[model samples]
Target chain A: MEPIMAIVVGLLYAAAIYMMLRRSIVKLVIGLMLLSNAANLLIFTSAGMSRGAPPLIPLGSALPDGPVADPLPQALILTAIVIAFGVLAFAVVLIHRAYNIIRTDNLDQMKDTDT
Target chain B: MSLEVALPVIIPLLTGTFCVMLWRHNVIQRVLSLVGSIALLASSIWLMVSVLREGHVVMYMGNWVAPYGITLVGDMLSAIMVVLTGMMAVAIAIFSLSSASKSHERFGYYPLMHLLLAGVAGSFLTGDIFNLFVWFEVMLIASFALLILGGERAQMEGAVKYVTLNLLSSAIFLSAIGLLYGITGTLNFADISVKLAAAEHTGMVDVIAVMFMISFGIKAAAFPLFFWLPASYHTGPVAVSALFAGLLTKVGVYALFRVFTLIFNQNPDFTHELLLWVAVGTMLTGVLGAAAQFEFRRILSFHIVSQIGYMILGLALFTPLAIIGGVFYIMHHIIVKTNLFLISGITHRLLGTYDLKRLGGMYKARPFLSILFLIPALSLAGIPPLSGFFAKFIIIKAGIEVEAWFVTFVALLVGLLTLYSMIKIWAEVFWKKLPEGIDPTPLKEGKTSGSLAVLYLPVVLLAACTLVIGLHGQPIYEWAEFSASQLLNPEGYIDAVLGGNRP
Candidate 1:
């Protein structure tokens, strides 16, 4: 399962890079989204994966009763996902505004600020 | 145990949230931000004093035990960084009051700036790598908003590249953190340091180090990864660009210094050597890039990259004195670079453009402003009795001590070229007759309705800071020495974070 997940993560990253290299700004946004998910999955799978009890304490005990899936990666990935979502939302709006004014989605055409 | 470590982060966070609520009232927002910045500056100074009195100050968020929960540690480096961030915050906040447009203020510029400051403080104060990522995102988002606040076409273009590259760096940074956690099963800086010391995967450790390097390299605007910087930085409003110029890349350099010194020092032969070459490349490319630019702010933007190289050079040398040089360089560069940008804005206000080809006669027109510009300009070029000279001298002297003649030579050469560019700006903008194309009479002073005098406040204050640090280099050098020692030996940091036997 871990190897398979790693392969999937690699594919996602490859696809992200490919899409990001496209000239269109929209593709770049898509690429960012894919890249972020790839990162989340990499974090998820790189830490060992297992089907185990939920991270819950039994009754009033101070700790979980038995083996449980590592909760840390999930928490970290969740945070990454939320942050990525916010950033992606902003990128979409920014690109939209840029496109509206520049009349193009081609990234090369948006070089007005560059020397 | 003291709450001082938390105050720098909390004050800005609370102020930012409150300002967001008061966004409807620009006057209230203005007052709240000013008060907030003053409070932040005071608290950061207090944090520095406390750190000076009692080594490392550690605060476990939510009373969580170290290694099990998040920690905020302020050693000399973090303490001074927070203070520097506080100073820039106050300057930028004041500058924004007079510079940001009504529409921009209406769109929560104050709130976003405060939020960015909070993120900067959090990044400096965090004792965990993951928390640093969180803070990076926090600040990156706020910066994105600030960059495009005016929604001008050029701004949108710059902001797109800025956000894309920054988000990419953040993703890379997060991925690295995950990989590190997987290796050590810990996220706390101290815990990871201890764990990595004994960890057997030497090859993987090197890989992770490079990953961290690339992640931070992008943010630091190091050579080969600094394209996004020049593309985006000069496109923002003066206040926004100045704040970005002052604090943002320094955060990346700070992270590089922190991680390499603390976690990755076990294999300095490989890592520091790579950093040495990187430093040389960054310095050369950045200055040459600046030398080619005609725009005022764009040239300053590229110079930021070059100056970063000197700091990294200090790090690459990996000696105690070298790191002190790096630390001092950070302090000096922040003030000088920000002041330079503010002066560029002043030039824009007076001359009506940033193009050097069309600007002139500032020496005769406004001797005061030219003097203000020259202070930072000369300091940047490593002129004696100025901040830049001290910073460059220390770093170059450290390189010579290490017998790294080549890099030392390159550093000196860059200093000469930097002087040339400074003179280029001086000759074009101030010394030569007012360009024929430019209006002979200064256009009604301030671009915005607000007083031009307000815009000069930060520039003047920062210039004075450069002078004070330049003349009184002993105390700052001593403080940086102490900071360098703290970084060199992370024992105090580790103990403060995970010693379990603390009060």
Candidate 2:
């Protein structure tokens, strides 16, 4: 199961990188989103996988510390997700404005104006 | 533990939020920002003196232990940067009061500026990597808003490139943090330092170092990643451009100095060589770019990239004296560069344009403004008995001592070219006769009073600071040496962060 999860993340990362190499502005935005998600998953999986049960113990039950999924990575990933979401939203609006003014979404066409 | 140490960050944050609430009352908002900036400047001075006497001061949040929680560490380097930010903030606030139009003021420009200051100060003072990331976001968001506040077509275009490149850098930064955490299982810088010192994974360490370098290199406008800077920085208002010039790239250089000296000093040979090559490339490219420009602000924008190369050159030399030179260079560049940009603002208002072909004979018109421009321009070109000369001398001496003669020669050449560019502006804009069909009478009549005078005040103050720092170089040199020693000897930082002698 751990190896399978790693393979899945590897594939996602490759796809994200490929998409990031595209020319269109919107696809590049989606590429960044995908890349961020892959990073989050990579961080999550590196802390080790869970097998037995959820880490939360019942109210009066004896706490078992043997093998639980690490909670810290999940918390970090959640924070990163929110922050990346905010950045992506801003990027969307910025790109929209750029397109409206420059009248194109191609990255190469937006050459340095001074030249 | 003193409140003075924290006020540099706190005052800006509080005032920013308060201004948001009082946005309708323009007078109240402006007063709040003015008082806040003044108080920040005072506190930064106090904090600098205290840190100079007491050494490094660490404040752990909520009474938590340093390793387990976040910490704000105030040393000579951070304290000096805070003071610089405070001073720049106050100057920009004063300039904006008279220069900013009603529409811009209505859009909460002052509040955003304060928030930007708060974020810059926080980034300088933070002792944890994650906390630094948070501050980067704060600064970026405020800068984003400030860039687009006018909603002009050119501004929106520039902001797009700025935001995109910065977002990509942030993503890379987060990935580096994740990698570091995955290996060491800790996010605290001091804790990670100790762990990394004990670890034996050389290959992994180099990979992580490169990741950190690339992320920071983009922010510092290093070679290969500096295209976004000249594209975007010229589009902002004069005050915003001035503040950005003074504060933003220095934050990246400061971070590079902190992390390399503290956490990644084990393998200096490889890292220093790579950084040296990058520095040389950055300098040559930046100066040539500056030489190609004809506009006032665009040339200055490219020079920011070139000057950053000098700072990185000092860092890449990896000697104690060299790092101290880097610190001095940072201080000198911040004040002089900001003053030069603000003077450009004055020129724009008086001459009605920034193009060299269109502007001429300003010396006969506004003697005071020409004097203001001359001092900083000469200082930037490394004239003797000025701050820029001393900074270049120290770094060049360090480079030669290390037997990097080729790089030393290249650096000197860059300095000469920089002087040529400066003189081009002087000859074209100030010395030559006025261009045809230009109404010289309006500038002559309107130069001495109103909004223009207010803008000149900040430039004058900054120019005075450049001269003073140049004249009194001994004390600043000593402070920079002490700061560099603190960085080179990472034991103190590690002990303070991990609660003393963890081994």
Candidate 3:
């Protein structure tokens, strides 16, 4: 299961990097989104996925009774997902503004600020 | 649990929230911000005093023990950074008073600035890796809004590149944090150091180290990863640019220094060697890049990269003296770089442009302003009896002592090149006569000299700081030494943070 997930993560990274290399700004945003998801999955798989009992410990015990799912990576992935969403939203709006003003989604055309 | 460790972050955060409410009343907002900045400075100074008097101060959030809950630790290094951040906040806040456009103020510039300061303070003081990521985002979002506040075409374009690269770095940083946590099962910095020591698979740690390096390197504007910096840094207003130039990238370097020294020390020979080469590359490329730029701010932007190289070089040296030099360089660079930007703002206000080819006669016209500029400019170039000289001297001396002759040569060469570029700015913008067609505009032409005088205040203060540090170098060096010693021995940090409870 971990090996399959690792392959999926690798393919996602490859696709994302390819899109990121494109000159179109829209593709860049899409690339960023994909890269973010790929990163989340990497964290998930690298942590060694466990589909087992809930992470909650019994009231009287200080530890879980049996094999338990790791909750830390899930919390981390959720946080990353939210932050990625906010950043992606902002990136889209920024690209939209750039397109409206500079009249292009092409990164090459956006050279006005460069010396 | 000392609450003073938390005040540097808390004060600015509360001020930002309140200032947001008074956005329409610009005067009120400014007054509140100025008072808030003063409070922040006071708190930071207080924290430093306590840290110096007592050893490392740790504050566990929610009263939870370290290694299980969030921790805010203030060793001397963190204290110094907080103080520096406070100083920048005060200077930039005062400068923004008269310099910022009314429209910019009305749209909550002060609040965002305060929020940015909060993020910086938080980053400096946090003892958790995950917490550091959160602070970086906090700084990022505020900086993004501040970058595009005016919504000009160039700004939008620059913000696009800036935001894209920064978001990518954040993603990478988050991924690294997640991976690190997955491997170690702890987010606390000290605990991770402990866990990584006992954990197997050193290979994964090395990979994550590189990932952390790339993330921070991009932020610190290292070679091969610094395109976003020069492309966007000069696009903002002078106040915004000065704040960014002063504090933003330094935060990245601070992160690198912290992460590398604390958590990644397990494999120094490999990691520090890689950083040594990166330092050399960053220094040469940055200075060479600066030599090509004719614009005042653009040249300064490149120089920021060059100076970052010097800081990282000290870190890569990986010795007590070298880390001290790095810490001292951070203190000096923050002051000098910011003062230089503030001077550029003054020049822009008076000369009506940033292009060196079009501008002239600042020395002849405003001798006082020229002297102000010369202080920081010469200091930046590492002229003797100035802050940069002491900073470069210590780092180069440390390098020579270690017999890392190649890095020392690169450091010296970069110093000379930095002097060359500073000379370029001075010659083009000041020494040469006003261009034939350029108007010899008086400093008091449009705005009241009162407001212009306000703009000069921070410049004078920062320049004075450089002069004082240069002349009175012993205490600062001692402080740097103490901080460096603290950094060299993570045992003290772990004991202070974990209270000797080894999990």
Candidate 4:
């Protein structure tokens, strides 16, 4: 089950990369959204999949010997998700402003400023 | 107190927040920002002295131990960089007081500037890779705001490319961090070094290293990833351009120096060779690009790329002297490059154009400005008795010592072309006859008050420091050598964080 989840996450990353290569501005934003999700998933999957029990160990209790999911990656991924969300919001507003001013969604048309 | 270690970051953070509140009162914002920048400069100087005297200083947030929490480390490299950033910030702040237009001033420019500075200092002083990424975002967001602060058509157009490329780099950087954390199971840089030392997965480590390099390379404006820089840098106001040119990309270079020397020392052959080629290509392409530009700001923008090659060349050599050379080059370029940009600002205000072909005979009108521009331009061209010459001399010496003949040849050739570009600007903009229909009356009409002179003072002071450091290069050289030694040995950094090796 864990391997299947990893495969699904990998496919999301592939789809994100594909959308990122599109010429339209809207697709680019979607691509960034998908890519960020894929990154979050990558962090989640890399810590090893566990289904046995929660990572919390009660005080005054003997440590469980069974496998437990690593909480560190989850914590890291949560932080990353918040950061990505902030970045995506900023990117979306920036692209919207760009579209409004330049009056075009084509990335190729936006290439006029490159010297 | 050791609390001085955090001043560079804290001052700017507080000032940025303050500026947001004082956004309506332009005068108060300017005055407060000026005071804040001066305070930051003083603190940075104190921190530099403390680091030089006491050696490496590490500050862990909330008393958290290394490998378990975030740490900010201040060594000589970061200390020097912080000082440089402070100096540039203060200079640009002073310049902006009188130069910034009503629109730019009203839109929270002071706050954004300080925010940008805080982000830069944070990125430099951070000891953890993930924290570095966070600071990169901090700086990026501030820059995005500042870039479009004008809302001009050109600015908007430039912001799209600038923000897009930067966002892409940020994404790449995040992926790299995720990969690194997965492999090492620790975000602390010092611990990662120890873990990487014992790891057996050389191939995977190499892949991660490339990811880090590409991400930073894009930010640093290295050859293949530098297209966005020139396009955007010229579109902003002078203060913004000066600060961005002086400090931003160097943060990227600083990160490259930190990561490559500390954790990724496992595979030097592939990484170093690739850097060498990039250095050569960046230098050649940047100079040729400058040669084709007739506008003053555009020419300066291209020079930023060309000068970056020198720093990258030092990294490629991967020796103590070469690294020292890289550090010194960073300091020199920040001061000299920024002075040139500020001088361009002065010229633009006086002449009403940045185009060299449309302007001339400025030497007679503004001799002080001419001198200001000449010193940095000559320094940039690697003339003897200036900081730029010594920077190039050290790198070229290191290259020959290592017997990297091709890189040495490219450095020399780049220096000559740099001189050509400088002389071209001088001949056209200062020596030729002043273009008709342009009033020279601005110089004669305006008051030579101290307030107006205050703007030029920062650049003049920076240029003087460049000359002073060049003539008295020994102390700086020694400091760079000391920092290089610390960087080459990660044990001191690691022990400070993880509290010595665990049994």
Candidate 5:
């Protein structure tokens, strides 16, 4: 399960870099989404996978009876997801603004600031 | 035990909430922000005093113990950083009140300003790596909104690259944190410092260190990764630009200093040595880039990268005096660079442009502003009797002591080139006459002295800071010496964080 997840994370990252390198403005957004998702999955997989055991402790017990999944990674993942979502939402709006103002969907055309 | 440590984050968080609540009343929001900034400044100073009296302040969230719960640790370095953030906040709050346009006020700028401050303070305070990510996002989101608030065409253009590149860096940072946690099985800084030192997988740890370096490097705007900064920083409102210039990259440098000094010290040969070469690249490319720029703000933006290199150079040297120099460099750079940005704003106000070619005759028209500009400019160029002189001198001396002769030579060469760029702006913006048909009258003409005084107040205050830090270098040097020791030895930090949270 760990190896499979790692493969999937690698694919996501590969795709993200590919998408990000494209000149089209929209691909960049897609790339960003993939990149964040890859990072989230990387966290999930790298922490070592467990079966369906929850992070919760048994009632009145200080510790779980069996090997429970690591809860901290999940919490970190949830935080990462929310932050990435907020950033992505803002990025979409910004890309829309760039499109409207720069009058082109090409990232190449956004070079007005470079000169 | 940790109440003061919490105040820096809490004050800004509460104030930001109030700014949001008073969203409809722009003037009131500005007043609230000013009051809140003063409160934050007070709290940060109090935190500094308490840290001086006592040693390392640590707080665990919800009373959870270390290695399991989030921690906030205030060592000497983080304490001083919070103080700097508070000072910049107060200055920027006052500057924005008089300078920010109606549309900016209408668009909830104060709330975002406070939010960014909260994130910056939180970043300085947090003891957990993952928690640092949350704060970084908070800062990034607010800065993103602030950058494109006006939605100018060029802003939209600059913000795109800025947003995308920063998002990528955040992704890299998040992935790095995840990997580190996997190896150490702990998220707490001190806990990881202990565990990773004992861990058998030394090579993997170095890999993660590089990841951290690359991500934080982008945030710090280092060489080859600094393209986003020069493109985007000058597009924002002057208040946003100045605040970002002062606080944002310094936060990145702070993190670098913290982690490299604390958790990543096991392989200084790999990490610190790498930083040494990167620092050289950063200095040369940044100064050369600035020398080529025709725009006033762009040159300043490029110089931010070069100065950042000096700070990292100090860190990379990894000696007692070098670390002291690094700490002092950040302190001096933040105040001086922010002051320079504020001066540029006044220049923009007077001349109605940021283009160097079109700007001229400020020496004749506004001698005071010219004088204001020269202070930070000369300081940045490493002129004597200024903060930059001490900062550069300490680092270069350390570099030579360590026999990093090439780096020392590059440092001196960069200092000379920095002078060239500063003189370029001084010549074009002050000595040369204004282009034909240009009125030298400021855009906001006939303003009462009260409002005009408001405009000059923050710049004057920061200039005073530069002078004070220059002339009275002993106290600040002492503070940096203590902070350098703290970074060089993290046993105390680890002990406090691992000692468990106490009331």
Candidate 6:
């Protein structure tokens, strides 16, 4: 199960890197979108596969007695996804605005600030 | 007891929120921002005093104990960083009052600035690695909006690069954090230190270590990774540039120093060696880049990268004195660089240009401004009796003592090059005759004198700070030395974060 998840993550990353190399700013953004999901999947795969119950304790118990899945990675992934969402949403708007102003979608055309 | 640890983060958060609430009242919003900045400064100083007098200040969230709960810890280094942030907050707040355009003031600049400050304060104080990532995002998003706020073509273009590179760094950083958590099963810095020290270090640990370094290196604007900085920094308003100049990359440097000294110490043979080469490359490349630029802010932006090299040099040397010099360099550089940016803002406001070729006659026309510029400019070049002199002196002295002759030589050579660039600005901007057809009229030339006064106010205050740090550098150096010791020896930090209660 872990190996399959790993392979899937690797494929996503390869696709992301490919999309990133394109000249179109729009595809560049798609690359970024793919990149972030690849990272999120990597986190999920690396945290190790476990068929454990939900992490909850009995009403009066101080701690759970059974094997439970690690909750931390889930929390970490949730935070990472939300942050990526906000940032990517921002990236989409920014590229759109840049397109509107510069009249081009090519990253090569966006080199005015380089000088 | 832990409230002291929380105040620096809270004041800025609350202030930013309230500033948003008073969205329609610009005047009231300005006042709130100013008060919040002062409160942050006061609280940061308070935290440092306590940390210096007592030991580390730790506060676990929601009554949870160490290693299991989120924690905020204030050691000497964090305390100093918070103080610097506080100082910059106040300086920027006062400067922004008059510097911001009406539209800029109306559309969320103050809130974003405070939010940025909050993120900086939180990053310095958080005991958890994941919390650091969260804080980085908070800072990044705010900076992203600020960079493109005006929607100018130059700004939007620059924002495309800045936003894309920073988001990539965040992605890399998040992935690194995930891998680290997978291995250590804990996010707390001190806990990981203890765990890794006890367990046999495998090759995977070194892999994770390099990953963290690369992500942080990008943020710190280290060599080969600093292209985004000069491209975008000059596009923003001067105050925003000054803020980034002072705090943003320093946060990255701070992370490097912290992780290397604590969690990554076990593999110094592999890691520190890499950092040494990185530092030298960063210094040489940055100064070379600056030497080529003629624009006022672009030159300064490149200098920011070069100065970071000195701080990293100190850290990489791995001596107590070197760490002291590194710590002192960080403190002194923040004030000096921010002040230089503020001074640039004034030069722009007065003479109506930032291109050095068109800038001139400030010596004859505005001797006072020339003097203000001299203090930071020369100090930045490591002149004696100014802050940069002492910073460079200590770092070089430590390098010599360690017998690292080549690095020591590079350090000295960079100093000379730095002086050359600073002198170039002085010669071009101040000494040369005002070029033909440049506007003699200041912006809003007929505007109230009081607004003009506000512009000079932060500049003067920061210049005076440079003077004080230079003339009376003993206590400050000692403070840096003490912090350096704490960094090298983290027993107290580990105990406080993982076991011992706060004072």
lDDT per residue as tens, model 2, B1-27: 566657788989999999999989888
Q: What is the C-alpha lDDT profile of model 4 across A35-107, one tens digit per residue?
A: 8787778777765667767977777878855667778878777887888888788778888888888898888
lDDT of 5 at B437: 81
Predicted candidate 6 versus true structure: per-residue lDDT over B248-338, tens digit per residue: 9999999999999999899888999889889999999999999999999999999999999999999999999999999999999999999
Worst 10 residues of 5 chain B by lDDT: B443-452
Residue A115, candidate 4: C-alpha displacement in angstroms: 1.2
What ranges in model 2 sit over 4 Å off? A1-10, A51-64, A67-69, A112-114
Ranking by DockQ: 5, 1, 6, 3, 4, 2
lDDT for each residue of candidate 1 in B1-503, tens digit (9 for 90 to 100): 68899999999999999998886999999989999999999999999999999899988898888887889999999998999999999998888778788999999899999999999999999999899999999999999999998888888889988888888888888888888988998899998999998788569899989989999999999978999899899988888999999999999999999999999989999999999999999999999999999999999999999999999999999999899999999999999999999999888878779999998888887888889999999999999999889899899989989899999999999999999999999999999888676677664343443478898888889999999999988999999999999999988889878886432
lDDT of 1 at B129: 89
In terms of docking quality, model 2 is acceptable
Candidate 3: misplaced stretches above 4 Å?
A: A59-62, B444-448
Two-chain DockQ for each candidate model: 0.78, 0.47, 0.72, 0.56, 0.86, 0.78
Error of 3 at B179 (Å): 2.0
Worst 10 residues of 2 chain B by lDDT: B494-503
DockQ (0 to 1) for model 2: 0.47
Once fitted onto the true fold, the runs of candidate 1 whose alpha carbons sit more than 4 angstroms away are B443-450, B501-503
Model 1's chain A TM-score stands at 0.92
Candidate that would win on DockQ: 5
lDDT tens digits, residue span B1-503, model 5: 57888899999999999989989999899999999999999999988998887778888788888878888888889999999999999999999978999999899899999999999999999999999999999999999999998999989998999999999999999999989989988888998889888888567888999999999999999877999999999999988999999999998999999999999998888899999988999999999989889998899999999999999999999999999999999999999999999988888877789999999988887788789999999999999899899999999999989999999999999999999999999999999988888886673365456666787899999999999999999999999999998888888888888974321
| Residue pairs of candidate 1 with colliding backbone atoms | none
Per-residue CA lDDT of model 1 for A1-115, tens digit only, reads 9888989999999999999999989999999999999999989988778886678888989988778878999999989999999989989988889988889999889888876
TM-score of each: 0.98, 0.96, 0.98, 0.96, 0.98, 0.98
